[model samples]
Target chain A: EADIYQTPRYLVIGTGKKITLECSQTMGHDKMYWYQQDPGMELHLIHYSYGVNSTEKGDLSSESTVSRIRTEHFPLTLESARPSHTSQYLCASSEGQGRNTEAFFGQGTRLTVV
Target chain B: QQPVQSPQAVILREGEDAVINCSSSKALYSVHWYRQKHGEAPVFLMILLKGGEQKGHEKISASFNEKKQQSSLYLTASQLSYSGTYFCGTEMRGGGSQGNLIFGKGTKLSVKP
Candidate 1:
């Protein structure tokens, strides 16, 4: 199994509540990413970080934000959750520049907002 | 942009063979293949860089045609363990330094006994 890990494998929160999905990797990878996936749909990149203090938005516009203060930790936060935010959140990390590197994914966190 | 995957889904029996194709409009730096089981994280199978390279993993193999900007995954003698949703992720050349991949909608594969 990959060393990457996502906290709160499953989360249930009321709408308007704040939540943070945690992702950490022990491999010390320089690239970290957060993706949102729905049933029978493609995984959409929401946020990613190349390294500490370097973050970028993905192709898909998202309401959530991410911070990479540490190489091993990249966390996604939503100030206020909504029904539309309910989805499976996956975290991944890749070594080196990412061009030829294969990404290792975490187990993912399934969030439900009501 | 996301690549286009053909045959949104496929079903095959053990010992059968199948092919999944992914096409992109942009120039690709590399193409990665992954498989995800129901309610599980995707597992990387292989990566094919430019120059129309081909790589194999066990009974699975993949070929990238840089000229056509397309890649194909081949599964020979499919086994029940190969049953899962197959995804093709493309890394466009100009995407940026981060090199994040843009994934296709996915192709569901079912291998029965």
Candidate 2:
């Protein structure tokens, strides 16, 4: 099915190491977003993009950053991973139509900073 | 801003009905419902637009109130498969710029057969 995909479904890394979580979609949706969540907790928006070449910070201040070099690709990178950054990262995309335009989510990447 | 979901968690018996409520502080253009099982991604349930509109599939449905900034999800004849955490996300009028939906903490529903 045409959907969003995230790589390395699970990641365990050491502190101070750099890592990038990959997110890609084949839907050609113009808007993409990244959300962080602890188990069974509220999802916090970390980063988002309106389209290719456009990226912005979300409501939650994140130590990681994202890049939208292509319309289908929006990858998040942490300069230096920390234990505080350990959480499940979810990637989603939306179409700017209808009052109820719902976003589609990826399987998510669970990062454990050891 | 993040929306608030009521009845943080609920336990139901199979074939029973349950209601989950979500309220936002700001005016909502639309509201979305999703369900997440243990160790799984959230799956779309339904989306209710403004102006007292509603939409649903199967036994799950939802309603949206633009004025009150509230939305409710109704699950009828619940099944064991309905056991999951439900979340409501709200989109505001001027929020299209960010293309992001503020999500509620989520309501955990356990359906015992």
Candidate 3:
């Protein structure tokens, strides 16, 4: 099993509340990513980091922001949550050069903004 | 660009077989296959790099065609545990060192016992 873990496997909060989704991996992978997925839908990349202090926005635009101050942690935060932001967020990490590597994923956090 | 997957959904009986195909419009450096069960994160099945390589894991196998910029996943003797959504992620040749993956919409596979 993958060593990656996400906190608050499920969350339901009121609108306008600030929330943070935590992701941590013990694999010491340099590449980490956050993806948003709706029920039974494809995953959309929201943010990714190549390494510590190197973050990039993915193809899909997202209001949430992520930080990678530590190699093993990549947490995503929402300034103010909205119902529109309600979706499952998945965290993944891959070792070696990103080119030919396979990503291992966490269990994912299911966010439900009310 | 995101890869395109054919046969949005498929249904099969236990012990049957199925094939899922993914195609990219741009040249690809690699193709990755992942399976996501209900209410869970996607699990990586395998990754196929350039050179038209083929990889297999137990009853699951995949083939990559570099020239066609396409990849196919084959599941023989499907099991109920194989019921899930399958996604194909493509990494473009010039997608940078990070090799960010752009995924297809996904194909849902349902296996009935």
Q: What is the TM-score of chain A in candidate 2?
A: 0.94
lDDT of 1 by residue, A1-114 (tens): 789999999999999999999999999899889999997689998888888998999989999999999999999999999999999999999875734678899999999999
Question: Fnat per model, in the order given?
Answer: 0.82, 0.71, 0.76
Q: Is the docking of candidate 3 incorrect, acceptable, medium or high quality?
A: medium
**Each model's lDDT:** 0.89, 0.87, 0.89
Per-residue C-alpha lDDT of model 2 across residues B1-113, encoded as one tens digit per residue = 88899999999999999999999888777888999998888888888877656665667878777778888899999999999999998777774533467789999999997
TM-score of the second chain, each candidate in turn, equals: 0.92, 0.91, 0.92
TM-score of the candidate numbered 2? 0.94
Tens-digit lDDT track for model 2 on A1-114?
439999889999999999999999998888888999999888888888888898888889999999999999999999999999999999999874443466899999999999
Q: Residue B4 in candidate 1 has what lDDT? A: 93
Candidate 2 falls in which docking quality class? medium
- For model 3, the superposed segments whose C-alpha errors exceed 4 Å read B52-56, B95-98
Q: Residue by residue across A1-114, what tens digits does model 3's lDDT show?
A: 899999999999999999999999999898899999999999898998888998889889999999999999999999999999999999998874634688889999999999
How does candidate 3 fare on TM-score? 0.94
Instruction: Give the Å error, residue B73, model 1.
Output: 0.2
Assess candidate 1 and give its lDDT: 0.89
Model 1 iRMS (Å) reads: 0.8
DockQ of each: 0.84, 0.71, 0.80
Model 2 error, position B32 (Å): 0.5
**Model 3 Cα lDDT, one tens digit per residue, B1-113:** 88999889999999999999999989888899999989878888888989756443656788898999989998999999999999999878873523777789999999998
